[model samples]
Target: MKHAVTVRNVEARPTAVVAATTTWREFPALWKPMLDEVWACLRAADIHRGCRNVMLYLDDTPRVEVGVELTQPCPLTGNVVSSSLPAGRVAMTVHYGSYAELGAAHDAVIAWCAKENLSRTGVRWEVYGPHDDDPAKVWTEICYQLS
Candidate 1:
C-alpha cells in the first residue's frame, strides 16, 4: 500500500503509562496486560481521559510505554507513571488497515528516511486511532523521531 510519509514537528504530550522492556515477539502478549494495569491505575488515580492508545517504542531491545493520553499532567500512581512524547521532528505516516499490517507503516518511514538520508534517534511510536467495528477501518499513526 502507498504510505504518505511526511516530516513534521510535534509538541510533547503527557501520558499515563506503564513502561516495559520486551521483545517484539513477546510484546503482543505483554502490552495489553500492561495497558490494563495502566487503565486500572488511572481509574484509581483518576487521571485517564483519552481513548487514544499511544505506545511509545524505544530502542532495539524494544522498550515500550503503553498508555492513553492524559487530560492534564498528573503524578505517579503505582505502576502507572507520567510520561511524555518527546518534542522533536519526526518522520510519520498513517497506516489504514489492521494492526497486523502496522509494521508496513514503520517500514515505509525507514525507507523514506533512508531515501532522504535522514537519521533517526531510535525512538518511535504508534498512536492508535479510535475504535471501529471493522478492522479495515482502523488507522494507526506511526512516527520515528529524527536526530
Candidate 2:
C-alpha cells in the first residue's frame, strides 16, 4: 500500500512521560496500564483540561524503550514532569485507524525513508491526536528524525 509522508522541522518541547522497555509482542498489554496510570495521574491533577494528545516514543535496539507523554496538559495525567528534546528535521505521517495498524504505518514510514536515502536517529515517536481516547477515530502522527 502507498503511504503518505511529510517532512518538517520540529522543536523540542518539555514533556511528561512514563518510560518503559518491552518486546514488540508484549507492548500492547504493557502500554495499556502505563497509559492508564498516567491518565489517572493527569485526571487527579486536572491537567487534561487543555491537553491535545499523548506521545508514545519507541526505541528498538539492544533494549526497547517506550515513553508515553502528553502533548498538552489537558487532563490525561497530573503532576507531569517535563523534559526537552533537541530540535531536528523529521519525516511525519498521520495514521487513521486502530492501534493494531500502527506497525504497518511505522513500516511505511521506514520504507519511505529508505527509498529517499534517509536514516532514522533517536527513538521513533507516535503522537496521539485529539481523539486518542477513542480507538476507531484515534489519529496518530508517527515521526522519525533524519540523520
Model 2 agreement with the true structure over 45-93: per-residue lDDT tens digits:
7655444345545456313322344455544334334544435898889
29-112 per-residue lDDT for model 1 (tens digits) = 999988888778766766545647899988989989999877655555678888888888999999999888887888999999
Off-target runs (Cα >4 Å) in candidate 2 are 61-81, 84-86, 132-136
TM-score of 2: 0.75
lDDT of 1 at 81: 80
Best by TM-score: 1
The alpha-carbon lDDT assigned to residue 16 of candidate 2 equals 56
Model 1 pairs whose backbones collide:
none
